[model samples]
Target: MTESVPPRSRPGPRRGLTERAILDAALRLVDAGGAEALSVRSVAAEMGVAPNALYTYFRTKADLVAALGDDLLGRLDLDAALGDADWRSAVVRLAADLRATLLAHPGVVPLLLHAGFAGPRALVAGEVLLELLSRGGLPADDTARASYLLQTYVLGTVALDAAELPPGAARPDDAARTAERRRALGGADPALLPRTAAAADVVAAYNGDAQFRWGLDRLLDGL
Candidate 1:
């Protein structure tokens, strides 16, 4: 019998896979199943490649998470916000944009918190924030403190917003539950908590956007 010739093997993703492509796949996985679903295996599976294929781009899950956070940070319009604006306005615009972006990808908040804003994009954004504060005439120490406060405020607000709901509750039911809780708080003992009882309506009317703006304005004013 004639000897059979061996078939050619398929090329590995080492040739075709890219960091951008891997980050894109990781974002899709997060969008579908949250950040917890992201892994070398899951991302590779999402891209229809072997798990080892991702090693060409990201050596570890932490690297992938950092890449994901940086990718998201790169999406913000910090350049535009920095241009042609007063420092206060620039800061407000940047903070609002950051919050909106975080809300858009709620699943990535934990990753951002864990990664602590290292990476090129995050650094650029930080530089812009500091520039704004410095241009606004804050001294070096004050500028550093303000930047930290702003970063903390933005990240903490987004984290709280993301963690507000338990999984699987319907929106209307959740709204009703929140309303009931507010009502209960409103009805608390006036004798024990006079200010809370007096401002019950204001307390119960907690609009997130309004609250965020109010807090941001107050912080900026203090700076």
Candidate 2:
């Protein structure tokens, strides 16, 4: 006595999509095409599913990006790498490892910059560092501040390392940037600029790895 429902009017396949699978596929997309290529539709296409299906797994794109960031960080096995190393050496190795990973995935560096350190991997890294510092006899306050200082330095270093020229952009060498500024201020003509250009090489040489290590060592010793 009621309108008949068609047999085809049944629930669709609930068999393939899962949160882990979606996140895993999203990670691969990011790794292969870079973070910019990651979108709900792209990931869904990668998984051969409807874009709306991903919404069930990740409420929003930010959630998916954060998940990808956490997965990326979890790849680093800091504890195993540390392996009885002294706290100072362990910290340095951690910094180097983070720098290497971030540099390798330059596309994802922006994700880290925007999100900062909020993922589960970040929390674990912070906790491990805190424990190591505490065991090394640093007071609670100093240990916390040192942790902040170390993380900030590492993030800034990675960000600088990932910098690149924008599209169709011609980045001036140091002397050029400086010369242009000087010219705008009516300080000197192009002739004076050539003389100052030679100084750029000295500045560049002074900012090499040796200088970095020197500063890092001195700072750590004070800590």
Q: Name the best candidate (by lDDT).
A: 1
Alpha carbon lDDT of residue 208, candidate 1? 66
The regions of model 1 sitting more than 4 angstroms off are: 1-16, 166-194, 205-207
Each prediction's Cα RMSD? 4.2, 6.6
* Candidate 2: segments with Cα more than 4 A from true spot: 1-35, 165-215
In order, what lDDT does every prediction score?
0.80, 0.69
Model 1 residue pairs with clashes: none
lDDT of 1 by residue, 1-223 (tens): 9999999986555866888889988887776666688788999999898887788678899889988888888888887877946889889989998988877767777777887778899889999999999988999999999999999998888888766543322123335645766878966899999998887766654536667898999999888
TM-score of 1: 0.82
